[model samples]
Target: MAQVEIYDGEGDELLFTGQFDFLPRAGESIARNTDDYFHYYEVIDVWHREDSEAGRFQACLAVKIVD
Candidate 1:
């Protein structure tokens, strides 16, 4: 489970939404459980689209939960 969608173009979008379920510390790598949270995603600036030449642009990254 992993979702991070942010898009707020002045009344044209979403602000913030974060979901988590990405455990990749390998059972338990010392240092206080390594890391479990503190992820961020951003792209909220009028949708930005000046030809996007190599700027790369993609949204919606949810649905990815395996056991």
Candidate 2:
């Protein structure tokens, strides 16, 4: 698993942050499947970081698609 941080495409708001089994690349879409609602976000950019203590992680910037 990888530590993932999902942020709004505008880079102003953070949508989600947690460990996920799947890592999405830039230009891909992520599906946020919830009990109440399901949303798809378009991945605009992705950044990876590595630290001795934190290990490897990814931060993704995405925009929500209205459908």
Candidate 3:
């Protein structure tokens, strides 16, 4: 599992955050902020960082608003 955070292109605003068993890959579209705007976002990039002490990996996803 991994954590996913969606933000604006400038990374100034956080759109959504959650944990997922499988993260969306680049180019995938996902509905976000459903409780508010119900906007769609496209995954732009995916990255991971190793947490040696925790013995796990953290995934970061960069996404952009599609509409």
Predicted candidate 2 versus true structure: per-residue lDDT over 1-67, tens digit per residue: 7778777877547888767777777777777777878887887877765555868545555565643
Better of 2 and 3 by TM-score: 3
TM-score of 3: 0.67
RMSD of each: 12.4, 2.8, 2.7
Flag regions of model 1 displaced more than 4 Å.
Answer: 1-3, 6-12, 17-54, 61-67
Candidate 3's C-alpha runs over 4 A off are: 12-14
Taking the candidates one at a time, how many backbone clashes does each contain? 0, 0, 0
Model 1 agreement with the true structure over 1-67: per-residue lDDT tens digits: 7443434334545545545464222222112121684433332232223337867543332222121
Better of 2 and 3 by lDDT: 3
Stretch of 10 with least lDDT, candidate 3 = 6-15
lDDT of 1: 0.35
Which residue runs does candidate 2 get wrong by more than 4 Å? 49-58
Model 1 TM-score on a 0 to 1 scale: 0.20
Order by TM-score, highest first: 3, 2, 1
Better of 1 and 2 by lDDT: 2
> Which candidate should be chosen as best, given TM-score against the real structure?
3
Q: Model 2 Cα displacement at 5 (Å)?
A: 0.7
- Candidate 2, after superposition: displacement of residue 6 in Å? 0.4
Better of 1 and 3 by TM-score: 3
Cand. 3 Cα-lDDT: 0.76
